[model samples]
Target: MITAFLHGFLLALGLILPLGVQNVFIFNQGATQPRLIRAVPAVLTATLCDMLLILLAVLGVSLIVLQVVWLKTLLFGAGLVFLLYMGWSIWRSPAGVSQAERPEPFSPRKQIAFAASVSLLNPHAIMDTIGVIGTSSLQYDSPDKWVFTASCILVSFIWFVGLAVCGRLIGRFDGSGRWLLWINRLSAVIIWGVAAYMGWQLLASA
Candidate 1:
């Protein structure tokens, strides 16, 4: 049981540890506008989306996704475009913008919606949860599968909460705007890198 739990945790970490679009956005929200109560909703929504994907994966639905040729290409193309757009947006935005200038404040519901969209729109998240985590869970028994699922859920909750809190802490700093700009730029670079890699993978497979 303990080993199974550990395995699940590792699997969850493998999927979530990368600085993907969702993570980058969460960190930005946390670090820049800590006072925005909406950030918590966003984080929780993202976590829930991840849990849902894991559920689908555990149910063996991921296999169907892998079997489809056009679906894979479509997903890859969408992800590439999304990541590139995000990167370009971040690159174009000025980091020194005040919190007041950050645009309309998100309501709690809207924050969750935004988070969900940010998480679920990325096809790679689906692949990671359904393909990678789902396949990994098969090594364990039913009980172990539960343990693994639980571990993944725990990781999601902990990671998002920690990220939100850290962002708030950073926002409290006086010169945080500069830091936010740097972070945004860093996120752009990471997103572009991921986009390039995904494009390459798709090309190789083709």
Candidate 2:
């Protein structure tokens, strides 16, 4: 059990530590929102989405779904489209340092939508969850499996909250908003790069 717990925690932490579209979106929300509380919707939505994916992956449901060729193609296509649009949206967002020049914060609805898109629509994230965590669970059984699942889920929740807090701290300290502007631009580039990679995969699979 201890081994399972440690394995799950370490695996989850390693998988999530990478910089990705999902991470970028959550951090941007935390930094751009007027208050940390305003970023709760994004934080919660992303965490929940991750929890769902982990559950599906561990239970082998996602593995079964991935067996369908058409579904895989569909996922890649949809993910590519949304990632491109999302990249554009982030890149164009205003980076005003002052309250007057700053654009309005995203409403809870928009935050939730974007969070879900980044979480669920990205083929790379889904593949990572299904490929790594899902396969890793095969090493355990019964109560141990459940323990592993719980550990992974717990890591995800805590990590997302921590990310939001870190972003908030940076936003609070960066009075000039120059950092935020660069962050947005960089995030957009990363997202677009991911989209292009996915597109290449889609074409290869074709």
Candidate 3:
């Protein structure tokens, strides 16, 4: 049990450590929002989404869903398009116009929806939770499997919350417009990079 739990934690941390689309958006929200509290909606939405996916994966649902070639292709295409759009938006956003300074704040509803999209649309995330976490669980017995699943779920919550907190800390020192502009620029690149990679994989599979 202990071995399975530790393995789950270590594996999950490794998978999530990369600066992916979901992490970037969460971190951006934390840095751009008026206060750290304002980023909670996105954080919660993302955590919950991961939780759901992880649960389904552990129960062997992903093995069935992933068999549909059409569905997988459609999801990858949609995810690619959305990533491109989001990347462009981040790159082109006005200067010195974070949520704190802008007259129009990003509503919680929109944030939650986008957070879900970011979590669900990305095939990479699904594969990690399902492909990696789910497959990993098959090696364990019932008790160990549940312990492993719980450990993985716990890591997701901890990582998301800690990421947001780190963003908030960075925001404190980056009062100048230069810092945010560069961050946005880098974020745009990372997002676009993911989109391109996903697109390539889709085409290759086709």
Q: Against the hidden reference, what TM-scores do the models get?
A: 0.82, 0.96, 0.92
Off by over 4 Å in 3: 97-105
Residue by residue across 4-72, what tens digits does model 1's lDDT show?
A: 889888879878988777888787667656484658777889889888888878878766876799987
Instruction: Give the best candidate by lDDT.
Output: 2
* Model 3 C-alpha lDDT per residue in residues 1-206, reported as the tens digit of each score: 89999999999999999989999988877766668899899999999999899999999997689789999999999999998988887788665645354322247997797789889999999988888899989899989999999999899899999988987787667766556667777878999999999999999999
Model 1 CA lDDT for position 90: 64
Tens-digit per-residue lDDT, 4-68, candidate 2: 99999999999999999999988888888889999999999999999999999999999899899
| Candidate 2 wrongly placed segments (more than 4 Å) | none
Query: Could you tell me the TM-score of candidate 2?
Result: 0.96
Error of 3 at 132 (Å): 1.6
Worst 10 residues of 1 by lDDT: 98-107
Off by over 4 Å in 1: 34-36, 97-114, 121-124
